[model samples]
Target: MTITIERTRTAPQPTRQQPAADPKPATGSFQTVQPDLEVTAPLGERYDEILTPEALAFLARLHDRFAHTRHELLAVRLQTRVDAANGRDPKFLPETEWIRNDTTWRVAGAGPGLEDRRVEITGPTDRKMAINALNSGAKVWLADHEDATSPTWANVVEGQLSLFDFLRGNLEYTSPEGKEYRVTASETPTIVFRPRGWHLVEKHLKFHDRAGRAMHASGSLVDFGLYFFHNAKALIEGGRGPYFYLPKLESHREAKLWNDIFTFAEEELGIPHGTIRATVLIETIQAAFQMDEILYELRDHCAGLNAGRWDYIFSIVKTFRSRGRRWVMPDRKQITMTVPFMRAYTELLVQTCHKRGAHAIGGMSAFIPNRRDPEVTERALAAVSADKRREAGDGFDGTWVAHPDLIPTARAEFDAVLGERPNQVDRLRDDVQVTAAQLLDIPSGSGEVTEAGVYDNVSICIRYIESWLRGTGAAAIDNLMEDAATAEISRSQVWQWLHDNTVTAEGTRIDQTSIVRIMAAAVADLPRFEGDRFDDAISVFRSVALEPEFPTFLTVGAYARFL
Candidate 1:
């Protein structure tokens, strides 16, 4: 499990100031902008380790250099949507055809701990959960700072603290019930940090431009900067460098932005070039078409691609919600990975990744087993097994599960195919010949809208949003690990249904008015909670879900409400 520098690429280094000429901070990186860093959020005791002056300076440097580009890329995202609305939808980029056609290039293959990721469990980075996940018997723990995490100041700071302890083999926790949880050497998973996506802003931290205008730093940069600044050397010493799961990238340009950030950070920290590895989440429809170029842009640092199913569905609905009924999707349950579009998406992912000698990781099975109910647990396991069997059989190197209880089942499925193998990267999936039409084919009769579906959507979203407001992002509801992505899917599907003015199977017509009623009733039925975030959550949900214009992500607006 040593850090793998064997396949590390040697490229022309970026020009930087000599250590003697630069002001040496505690992190040993030169400070570019020394503007006063402000933390507006509540600072808990012991957060100093994560938000040290040197770390804040590192974050400020990253923001000063790349925050403008992040803004520009967001604008580009809006413009892409506008162009799609005007009949210039995203397609295979002719300009980047050379990158896709050239088969000679391959990404830096799997790094040390990531070489075998047959089953990666994902969860928020609370101390207890962090300890449990690292010992969950999964190959990798997606230490999530994104959808599975609510951006409360305490959670953010404490999560960083947990990761700091994890790398040093000192992660420990004792529950209120006196249950002790600690990392074990016998079953430790590789840690892959999933920062917030590019769309989010860290309101707690503020930076000023040269013009003296204050602005919030990009959440992605903050999470990435703080983690790399604090733990790059520690993780490397632990036989792994900083690894990331980049989510919701829409194009190769975004991926290139990430690559540039990686390069800059590596040089700034004096780490080896290509010491960082990333797995891009192909969660957006636009990114699906640009997988080849994304990998190409980060080839020197890319590890693979992931099939992020729920958010991918949310993207499809959000991107094409105004296109009339032709692209209107059915119930979420019916649009499982076996559907035409999803199958094409997964097949294309495996084909593209294996073609370029990268690992092709499958989507998440978010079912948290019901330990008290044997029948429910068995059924969940059966479904998860089938999903992994399909993925492993179809040439995927690994798959994801949200709960540790299902890890043995998922691992067994992959073990059937990857016996004595770290990964199936050599399984090139030459048989997957997918075309644009095949990938975009909206399946007919996927599922009918029903009264049950409508109510469930409202209920699940309200439930999730309430927990999110209370500082928990991953909520166990109905035996499923529901995160912001699931809430997105729930709300977006309802919006799509309302947009299409579709009638349910049981003759219930879904309208904005009806949805509002359902939302009200859903909230009213819930037991009294301690806070008013339920009201705020419902307000945000209604605006994003029922409005004429769809917001990019529910968390963006909802985050501002609480965090």
Candidate 2:
């Protein structure tokens, strides 16, 4: 589905209704009430409400003071609007309909064709890495200020300072191969910088231009406010990219707030309204429940939603940790895509996005291994391909790749899936039948567990069980309980779990073992079936698990098994 929104220019409309009466005085100093009716407080208590008559008269007398303050605020807002309009808002380009409609800005909507497409390049630092990622072929490359790279106050300041430099074509960086690359003033890619947390705006102001001006001098660049200030010709002349991926979103309000801010920024920046695009991550259970509302909030601007696997799992565990015995753990392998709720969430995302003429994108394939090992690379590539295939089959337009080596595999997977018609499989409906017992088992200790100490043991047990079932190789638990090659693939499955949790000298944790165990568990948990049919299905599961790697079916299988 393709979504095209036209940008329109318009003045700002009042967001709140006028208050009926002046606000009453507070205990000591006078306080104003919020103008909105929803503010339950009495008049004069809310910030936007006018104070008592005396206070109002006094405020009237200080018209000049208020005017001065108002003018200053307007100036700051205007500057921010300009910056945001021009795509120089520091952290991200403010997404608004106007920005999207601006004749100067053009964003190539990347869909299934570009899902697995990535161009690998190196940069000297995280900033450089960002620039290179943009230049590299992916439609969006997150300048991770959050996880992959560590940036201190100085780094943040320098990075912001370097934005203009990057735009002006004066950025240089050395690749890992020791090759130096320079970006001149005329070259710019679709770039987005992940800023420090909203609370750290003060620290981001340390670096300024040659005149010793702070980047955030007007206080317009606070807490995503930067996306509004830099909207002007100076920035857009290079290129106005109207998109952003909002990470770590925990509620519908956050999405709604962004929508409101974008609405205001569009008007202030003179950009066409509704041009900016955003993608919110469903990383927490709160976000999961609010998905419908959150997506509704940004329907016009939203590109799609992503299934944030690891963080989502972490959130589930955290949200339900207090339940004690009621808490059942998710299978490690199934954690990525298999939880029934997660599957439901993903399907809802896809359905919502498609319904809105948007493209649903998948989350990261973190299992892709290092590039140095040929065997690892091949395995990683195969796994990535399978994942992409599953995502495509599941109606996702794209997926994420952490390492460059997985790029080709991801692309191929997307291509293969895209080549097939969507909705081809009758069983591909988003809904899956799950019983109450299955739901209960989701948090059971015997189910997939996430407790810190038990992860290794559970993982090992799962892998060993699968291996034994495969009848290919023997598997042992803690170097004991060795099972000779047997038709019981369940034992080998246990070994597979152990392998997934095994910590190598290189510090890389592979999920292959977990994958096998998940498959075995699924086979073991199949519904009551007599003789041949059950045995045949179990054999197929064992064969797939014994294979090097499979697609993201672990989640589906595990969820089914749990059910």
lDDT of 2 by residue, 63-87 (tens): 2112234334445534543443343
In model 1, where do residues sit more than 4 Å from their true spots?
A: 1-36
- lDDT tens digits, residue span 303-370, model 1: 99999999998888888877778778877777888888889899999999998988899999999888
User: Residue 196 lDDT in model 2?
Assistant: 28
Error of 1 at 343 (Å): 0.6
- CA lDDT of every candidate: 0.85, 0.43
For model 1, state the Cα shift of residue 296 in Å: 0.5
